[model samples]
Target: MRYPLLMRFLFLTFLLLCASLHADESPDTIAPIRERAMEHQKAGRFAAAVDDFIKCIEEGSKTNRTGRRAEYFARIAYNQTRMGNFKDARENMEKAPRQNGWKDEDPFLMEMRAIVFLATDQIEPALQIAQKFKAVNPKKAEYFEMVAQFFGGDEKCLATPLGRFLFDPEQLLYNGAVARNPKDLIARRRRAAYFLERANQQRFPNSYPAKIPVDRGGWAHLFDPATAAGLPYSFYASAFYDLSRALEMCSSQDEPFLRVRRAGAAYGWNAVAPKNSLFISAATIAGDLKRAQKQGALDVRTQRALGDFFSETLPPVDQPNYRPRLRSGIQSYSRALYFTRDESSLRDPDWLETPETDSLQKVRAARSTLIGFHLSGKPVALPDLPPLTELAWKDYGNTLVAREELGSALEAYKKALEFDPEFVPALNNIGTVYSRLGAFDIALEWFDKAVKADPKFAIGWTNRAGVLDELGDVEKSLASYDTALGIEPQNAQTWVSRGILAMNSKSWASGQNAFAQAARLAPQNSRYAALSAFAKFANENAELPKIDLSIEDKTWLSNFFGSDSLAESYASKGAADKVFAAREWIK
Candidate 1:
């Protein structure tokens, strides 16, 4: 009995030794490490993933699994590229084995090589690789080709039929992907982004006669004909639809960004052209025109055109049809805020402690990750959500402002400040709300804080100038206007405001110059033209120039001249100095 038991024990020991030896050469031995590496990659810890992938390659090499080792090498190279180690990525990519004795035949290896080439700005090689894989993986290949074309930035190439088909909104490649798979969040997001970019291009066409630069403050009242063209409602509607679908398909980690984007699209859809109103219409303006004519106001063909313009441009006189859409946007931003705030605790500690100066850089980094995922079919990790939370609150505040809920808008903006006290937009908006409420001193204080936070903020300076003007600090207001103009000379609205202040102060020459500049910047706006003419007449005591003044402008002048007929008589006589005496009523 003792000899039989010893024999059983020895047999078990021999089997265990053999199994251990087999494990060393089995692919299953690397499974745990591979899983860990994939987890690291999915979490955006590319450096850690690179190390694990290197270990996988080492283990695969021991098993003489050349194909598996090649895959591991490709993975390592991809992770290295994500980590911005381009040289290392290229070196590792070169280690991946050629398939069937052809270097470009292996789809996975080619993909890794193309990505590395793209990272290194080798657009031509990337394009070649993309073309080579066109038949093997058309979806990925098309994406690579599109990115290569974008990086190449060759106008001649983009003007070609193939390039137009690739980049044009009507023929976008993502449209096909989404059509094939409605649940493809990446395709939906990309299509939505494409529509938005197209809408922006339409809103600010390159062929526009006057190119008014967009202001830093993003103030809504800037007068630019290009902006007046407005983004087509259909574009935003399409974008909103795709974004809504993406939201339905996206994971919880992606919900915040998608929600924010959807909210923005909703806002754009609600705010675009074809003004919604229950009261104001062409009929109302026509009736008003008849009354003016009965009162002997000089009614001309331009008056009808002005009425049409007003009918089209004016905000709804009552609650708009799009209020529910604005409310929906508000709800989306609220949900985004909730998700971001709840997930903040899970963010890297270093991100939470990032300095205010680095906030923009962090946002750019998050955007770059998104761009990479969009172009390369890479899985993006959850980006830092806190910086975006501030944007959520600011945009929420803006929607509330659009809804005319000033009190709620203040609360939303204050919430934004809670996330980032130095957030310039929130601070500027708070000041704007206060100015609208007639609390000039408090508004000035907030504007001061905004400009102090970022001296280069032109909008903050402009807001400060307006508040100063209201508070009778004319010199300081003018200086602030000068600073804002120095920052953004193409801001026509600022020029108009500065001109109005100049005229009120009886600085006639300066008023004329500012008004002329505004008119030069916004040539399509007849209101600016009229203002310039009036300023010129007032400054030089010259004959009144022929300018198309809107009905509202004529009414303003009528109020000043004591009657519509008297104002017309003064204009007919070029008695501009007499008209200039009514400058006190300018505002």
Candidate 2:
């Protein structure tokens, strides 16, 4: 009955070979791998979950069973949709068998199909597919009903038991994931649309007594600011509320639904270029330029992409010294523009460009120190400006700013404001001029108005923070600066300013770290590099003062300052380095 030694060895070797082969097998070969992928999907780790789902789909497709293959394809399509891979999602959906019996009616398959359509902004088609589930799938009837109601506009459906569950934050978040966004330019924009759709049902509720749910709760609709506890009953109010929530959510730190949040929500803001920081979706910028380049160099799209690279900076700091990249990019843009004559505009009929204004060339010149044209022989002639319009005046102001003629710039800004009273850029520029002139209070006023004119104008916050710092409201200044960073964390100038504030506060190490960040963000900025070097030198030469530390200060330094062994070091050890390092941030 006992096995021979040779047979036992052969059996063990076969098992080892099988194990080795399994490592290279599709994800579904291991049940736990598939389960982990599902877990990743549920946790909104879409990018990571995508590969695992594809492996599972490959395993399923390898099977002879048509139903199993269809199910895998359908499931993977949902994951692909979440990953912003519209092409892959569509291909998977197409490959899945529509005629396979029962698999055709599978709720998950049907839901994914609707999801794909919805994600691409095909609402009517998605709603129709979702509607089929109402009678065909009883367990999912509530979910399908919720979808129909979102598109159908009926509050009565929401008052139903199923509606309560389906309209909850959990459900709306799933729908938000399916909203029309690929590069994540705006997650809150999608969430806003979700709430706006939900609120449409209640545009004019027919329940005469106005039977609002006493406490079944409005948590699901938190993203829908319209459903706030004490709002007046106007659809406009609700819609506007959602709109406000959308903008506010652009930088809110503590969004509860981080799991369902877009990738941008995590790392959306960071320095894209040297000595400049602005709120830019790098994905959108790259995507747009790629699309534009297909049209050729003469195309307005191509020129504009180059122009943005040349002239655009967050908050438009009057940085007289531009980096080499700016000059190179502007040189490229000017070369394209020079192809046409010193004629009327960027849109001369013979130039074969679109209807952009004549001011674009002038504005470009004003924005940079580069020669107005790449070819000196083909120099762009500056036309005399009697500014009748806001844009013309704005360009004139730009010219004045370039020349350091603050008085003339101020007048030009005034003219711009007179032409268009709500011009936010002029408002910001007025603040900039006043700040430059050391008129801090007036500058702050204009900055406030600029933000009021357009809260999403990140430059307003940055400019306002500078004014606040000048006025010596240190706490308020810090808060304002933080707000600006929240809005557009990529601004290297702002990081430099933040570092200066840290240095002023005598948090030497924190200031050093902040300066390092600024230097990393803008290595071309000589000022930031100098400040970083100084901070490092200061830290290296740290010397403890004779002043005794309070227990609270000691606790703070130990806990928050990453010097956890400070108390022990200062008391037991006479290490001069430890003493000095511990005192680096102390009062």
Candidate 3:
């Protein structure tokens, strides 16, 4: 579970060589101390290694050999970098000699300096040093360059303007690195991080457009490059793929970080395509976290990722075992908060220091989500969360609504409105809560405000239609449905709602067409198929199409119509009238 055997062997060999170099130049008293320091560094006891390394440096300074003393400085700096003491590492790295002549310790010295630069967000300097090894060691140079590029793409690596180039337009650098070495962990991780960041920046509904054209002949459209190019979720899918590859090559020390990234990408993909074969289930991600937990203690980032996965990515509240999942999520968030009690306590030695304030805000928000679910409209003391943006507050309100805490949800939505009066989602959700409370007139006003704020918001228009229907304004409701469908024609639920409205108004042909469109858009749903057939039967059509009934579909048909065979009977036009008379569609 440690680093690969060959890599460990090479690292130990390098350590031994460095220790043996100029052994007689330094006092024999320093040899055993330096060896112990190397052992401590390799064992991940960075604090102990730093202490031992300092002692060795103190002993080496008594000798007159400048090169050997400079090497000791570099050695201490490497340990300091591993301990997240980048400021001290940088100071020590500056004291190390940078002569043009190659020596046994030169490669280690250069690598330590580059690592210090990268740790301190100095990407350009890191790249410069990384390139120096190109002539002497091409593979090592490639590895360092890939590492430099990875840091260059980091959002926090702002010491140089080159950080803005997240990836090459075609990602040729990452691709070339992987091509040269298929097991290049840095290249794979960099690619994954790039896509994950891109996915984070994309807005919902716009990035996830409604009208994705489908070729009914087959699922070839799903695999089409053009189709993927238009969807933001494709970035998440790509990130998941790259992270999976990286995890295969990563050591156990690196596994938690990669697993957490992959889990995030998996959650995003599952949100968009839960029924796809490639969809990573919440259970699978939960298992991954469990395995990681069993490995040893987790860092703050890993714990936070685990908390988010449990709290937000689990199955819905109505599903079985949801209570257990919710409890687990709450515990995970609590643990995250426990670890993040202080900035210094959160040790993320693998990367630079993450903003402690930002970490706290996210952990607090996640805890609030679980707490809101637990309280469910009951008064309870909540965590003092940092101020959230309108979008964040609105999302929290949505989560409360999902938990069925209507009163608290309304309060949260109103809070979002205080931040941005014209926030459309908050307005629409407020309307939805009122509608659920049977306040149709108030819901209509809120819906109107939402659409007025953002006329392009199809969901707002759809809600307006539903409220109008509740108020018995049939003509206006139909008009609203038309407007909504025009904006987002591929929304199958909107079509279904519109079809129901048409059926109530006795517009048989319109209902039939709406239900048929819904069926075509979501062919996997047997309910849409049933609704379409019923609408056709109600229209007195001469030709009646049969409904495809799976075993579950047959059970549903039996429960709804008192006979499972009625769907099969509908295939023959002669029995269509009898099938229609079997159940009243006026519910």
- What is the alpha-carbon lDDT for the whole of candidate 2? 0.52
Clashes per candidate, residues 3 or more apart or on different chains: 0, 4, 0
lDDT values for all models:
0.59, 0.52, 0.64
Of candidate 3, the 10-residue stretch with the lowest lDDT total is: 214-223
TM-score of each: 0.30, 0.32, 0.32
Which residue runs of candidate 3 sit more than 4 Å off their true CA positions?
1-182, 203-223, 274-278, 281-283, 340-357, 379-587
Q: Pick the candidate with the highest lDDT.
A: 3
The TM-score measured for candidate 3 stands at 0.32
lDDT (10s digit) by residue, model 1, range 356-440:
4543333334333322222232212222345548889899778777866676677778888988999999999999876664445
In angstroms, give how far residue 317 of model 3 lies from its true place.
3.5
Worst lDDT run of 10 residues, candidate 2, spans 258-267
Ranking by lDDT: 3, 1, 2
Model 2 off-target regions past 4 Å?
Answer: 1-28, 39-48, 60-68, 83-88, 98-102, 120-125, 135-291, 309-366, 369-587
Tens-digit lDDT track of model 3 for 406-509: 76778788889998899998999999876765445567899999999999999999999987775556788899999999999999989988988886666779
lDDT of candidate 2 at residue 534, scale 0 to 100: 50
Cα lDDT for residue 530, candidate 1 = 72
How far residue 179's Cα lies from its native spot in candidate 2, in Å, is: 15
Model 2 / residue 140 / CA error / Å: 6.9
Could you tell me which 10 consecutive residues in candidate 1 have the lowest summed lDDT? Answer: 216-225
